[model samples]
Target: MGKHSKPSGQSGRTEPASGVRVRPLPVRSAVRLGRPSDIWHKSALSAVVAMAVPALTLFALGRLDLIFYTAAGSLCALYGHGLPYAARARMLLWVVLGMASSVGIALTTASLTTSAELLVVCASLIAAVHKTVFDAARLGPPGNIILTFITASAFFVPQHLGQVPLHVALTLGTGVLAWLVCMAPALLRPQGPERIVVARALDAAAGLLRTEPRADGVRPAGVSDAWHATSAAVHAAWRTLYLVPTPTPAKATARAGLERLLMRAESVLGSMGQEAEEADRLRAWARGLRGGGPLPGVMLSAEQDVEVLGVTGEVSDVRRPAPCHPRGVRPVLARLAPGSPLLPIGARVAAGCVLAGWVSMALGVGHPYWAVVTAASIYQANTTLTWQRALQRTLGSLLGLLLYTALLPLIHVGHLAMIALALACMLGAEAWISRNYWLGSVCITPLALLLAGFGSQLPARVLIADRWIDTVVGAVVGLACCVAVTNRRAADRIEVALERVAAAEAAASRLLAAGPVSGAEGAREVGWARDRLAGCLAELREAVEVASGEWWQRALPDERIDHAQQQGHRALALLVRQVSMPAAVV
Candidate 1:
């Protein structure tokens, strides 16, 4: 469904040597959005609880003027949803610190210069840097976009040099509280995140199995997409388990069970051509994992007879002694260089924010940062995704404005009531954000309006009017930027990615061709090759998908991508079999 078919020679493209026509598989559109997954619910809950703590505390203390700062700090909780407890702790710590730094900088800049133009320039630069760091680190959801929104919006908040320290402290203090809230769930279920990851992998594998095959035994369309997703989930599950700082006895046992499940999933993929009942078994196991029940045994007697290799524990132990080096600023700056693929995206974001902010101020909007945030929200990996975001943001904001108008008079009755309503909207926004950006935007719009009006008590009508105006201005400006700043290097990136994948596949194929290895050094080499091939395949998939979505891009190397992916999956399956039965290959 994501791809389209057109006659191969329609655009002056040569036909293949077989003398048969082939269709170029171009992406249908870049605007594909999916429903909310299970993890999204957890993220929404964490955000709500985290924000409520500081929000209600400040409200009780009659310090409602500081709610914006607290809300800004609470945003730190929205990150690291997929990480293990130990890894999550480290990520959240960095996120909270980063949020505090951004807030401080914004407030300081506002105090130093009353010029809106200067503020826009500063915010734009910060947004670019924030986007760079977030992309480099691959810090998942509530990603750089939301962080940029919070910091950029802070630029418009009136600030004084005397009050800067107090506000920064408030943000830092509440940020710590938010961090605690996000991590607190780990105590209740230490292995919960890992379990979720394995469960998702199992579910994805089952989905692949359920796809009907064509007469030639090839899987149905979109099977590649499903396989890609399943592979990612499996890889993430292993990484999460291995990265656990210190696993308790129970967690260790759980980890062992998950390892077995992973092996079973790989076996299913290896035996995809056969009509096996393992698909149902995998689905049942997934359900059991999600439901926290005892896992059922594999029904494939012959497959089960294959030794469950001690691969998981050994790999983790061998890797544990390695020192962890934090990524340095040099690499991040290098990524932001003019020649980098992401450079164009970051540049567009900066330009859009600056121009949108200028337009908002020129139009005398009360909150120009609203326009900046909206502009930031509309950017995605490609122009098509950006277009989708703009539409979703505009629609969501309009509906959100309606909801805000209806509830504003009621909320104004008391400060506590307004705070409560804001919290509720924030919770809803997080809940719906994963389902659809527009749905999430509806909640975010009102919540933002409420928070913006908290200390100032701007009239609801005025707030609504300004928001509508800003939304249009930001969306228009952002879309214009998308059209103007095209990623000219998208096709070139796909070719580079294909070369990397080819190299990785060749290395892996050589390892398999050599048969089972003896000695630690040989085994390590094999394992490294397998891991490298897997990572390269994932990168290729992402690169192609993104490039395919760009407007006015050259035809993608669809056949090359498909062939590399198929070879990569086959190599992985062979590696899995070899690990289980070391002598089988030879």
Candidate 2:
């Protein structure tokens, strides 16, 4: 039952008002929506669009020479789309390092021997280790995994050691070209738009809370959906922040605003659980209150506090509404101001780089594919999840190799159909694997099999042996590095976030006790408290996830800790609303 359990919320209903004029509503659904980003599209285009060029280059080199490294280079387009330029620059450097290492290892292994079985086993072990360790490093998705698969079998290619530098140089060059394609023209500015987007999201959550169904009814479908949707968006914003080259003023504000919005959203979610029966019926009626227009007003102050977020579109000058609070309570809702405690950008990037570099040294020193896996393994908003990802990578790599061996003969090595199938699988894997790593691994194994065939004529048995070997080696070395490098400040971050939540709650209490409040300033303060709490919660979630996976994590009072923090958050939300009514009506 818990598996199907849904969080409670205000029911969608509307109370009949006497003497009110009823008008026929429009047939269209009314809901606020933000413009979408094209990061994925851009990244994909940057890589695959250049497919023709890679083939041509290989042709020019006088060998249908399997554009193996070209595939590795294709991933470079996604490297720095969301980061500050400096961070992106740094990441690019690391990507190159990782790629070089992967290709180097595969080439070395391939050239070192002609035994098909030995090569297969070796490649599989290295592939496993590559997957495991890179995940532990926290490098993240569209990461080095692709590169690893490509290079792990580069060993089977007939190229001599003398050709290693040339091969690596070409791959890196292609990746750089992919990177340039995305950076050439920046169309939509994210920072300013993001600020408005987050603000709107916060506003929507508050409005939903204010009109939630009463205690005796089912939650409004849309409001409940929004809760999950917003949570995901908040997470995405953090990831986007990680990708950006620099923190623009607008983005910084947006980031801060997002943190506050999350806090408010959580408070609203809690309130929905406590609404009375009257509220529930009202929620149901109101759920159908359709109008093709902007959101309902929840007045707050901070609109003119700073200059307009200069953006391309016609900027709206609407003032923010004050945050709504429940009657008869005085929680510190206003204290949840947005702050810098959300994303541990520096720590994540630094640790990720180190993990990547180490994996590169180990895998890169011999075969570059292992280094690629290391890059994929190390990325996560939470370091602990990074470790889990590493585990998944190892498991998937071993399985992938096995699957590849089984299907090898059916595909007919060096055939156009096999290559096409491989590319198709790669595309599908990237698209669907987002659901989970293992599912993606299933497809990736087959793709790798085809790619290996592109450069050599090894039979099914030999291919199977070498693939498994690379996986094991890569997984082992990667995890070891995780133990060596610890995210020392993870615990402290959780502690500090809890403290901030407490502080925000306290502040909201002080403001509400004073009496009725109104105007944008009041709303801003309330919104701020709500957002900060959300951020604290996010941090807490990350910490818990990390602690669970971290092999070296010591004992932590997780149960007691999370319980007390939630209690504080609930109290803050209720008290802020209770105390604001008197001053708010004025």
User: Number of clashes in every candidate structure?
Assistant: 0, 124
Model 1's TM-score against the true structure: 0.87
Clashes of 1: 0
RMSD after CA superposition, every candidate:
5.2, 14.3
Worst 10 residues of 2 by lDDT: 1-10
Query: What is candidate 2's CA lDDT for residue 28?
Result: 15
User: Each candidate's TM vs. the true structure?
Assistant: 0.87, 0.55
Estimate candidate 2's alpha-carbon lDDT, on a 0 to 1 scale.
Answer: 0.48
- Per-candidate Cα lDDT values, in order, are 0.74, 0.48
